[model samples]
Target: MAELYFLIYVIVFIVGAVSGLLYSYSIHLEPFVVKEKFNIPILIMAIIGWIFTLNFSLFSMIPSFILISIGVFLIGFVIDMRPGYGRKETIIGMIISILIWLITHCVIL
Candidate 1:
């Protein structure tokens, strides 16, 4: 069961990463240029998700995930919309965090 949950997490994470890449491209954010730089943030999000999964029950985790994801999205949106910044690393971070939360909480053992 634990293996299955991990598998689901990996699948979701990959999908999220790809989606983030596409989204960045669509907005002309040039993810490829800074792809290597964002690795630490993405890894941090995954670590946070893993910690949440370990500490909380599925029922509790769902709402937390939703709130966290929404917050991350809003932050990312705001950053992208800022006049001078023009970065989209937040989108990638958001995707990773949300997908990790979903996969970790949704899997039935």
Candidate 2:
């Protein structure tokens, strides 16, 4: 189950990567998805989702993950630790990652 859980998380992360390519405005009737990959940080920040839902049942993991996430973001952005970092896409990834948490909590252990 844990293996499957992680695999699902990978799929969710891919969805987030796709979301990163999308923009609010589109060129003509198509090309809303950007050709340039600008959201590498978003894809790399997949751990954020895992941390976000760590507290669904385990209270400690939740708070710890939240703190760690904040620290990573702070260090990454404030210190410019990472290049090609996309905040928006990372946020999207975090939201999408929650699906795994929901599934684990509601359907599995």
Candidate 3:
């Protein structure tokens, strides 16, 4: 059962990352060029998502979504604040994460 939940978490995280990547492209962020640049931040966000899933419960869906969204946003915001990176790719990532959470929430319920 635990393994199944972890697998679901992994799938959700991948979908979120893909969503973020597509969004970045739409916004002209040139994801392919910046792929190496944002790898750490994306990994951090995935870890956050993993932790969230570990404690996730149906009744706490709204709060969980909010937390995950904030986590993604912060990861982006922090990375943007760094010296070299200027664009707000983190916002795009947050959108992807929120979308994933919403979709999975609906499916699970």
Q: Please count the clashing residue pairs in each candidate, in the order shown.
A: 0, 0, 0
Badly placed stretches (over 4 Å) of model 3 are: 29-109
lDDT of 2 by residue, 1-109 (tens): 7677556555554554444334222222343433455445435454454344443344455455344444344323312212233445555555555666677678785
Candidate 3 lDDT, 1-109, residue by residue in tens: 8677556545555555556655545555543444345546555655454334433453364676555444444443333343334343444444555666677767666
* Order of models, best TM-score first: 1, 3, 2
* C-alpha lDDT score of every prediction, in listed order: 0.47, 0.45, 0.49
What's the distance in Å from true for residue 8, model 1? Answer: 0.1
TM-score of 1: 0.35
TM-score of each prediction: 0.35, 0.34, 0.35
Q: Write the per-residue lDDT of candidate 1 for residues 26-56, one digit (tens) a residue.
A: 6556544433444455345444544444433
Which candidate comes out best when scored by lDDT? Answer: 3
Query: Which ranges of candidate 2 are over 4 A from the true structure?
Result: 1-35, 46-87
1 against 2, candidate with superior lDDT: 1
Q: Which prediction has more favorable TM-score, 2 or 3?
A: 3
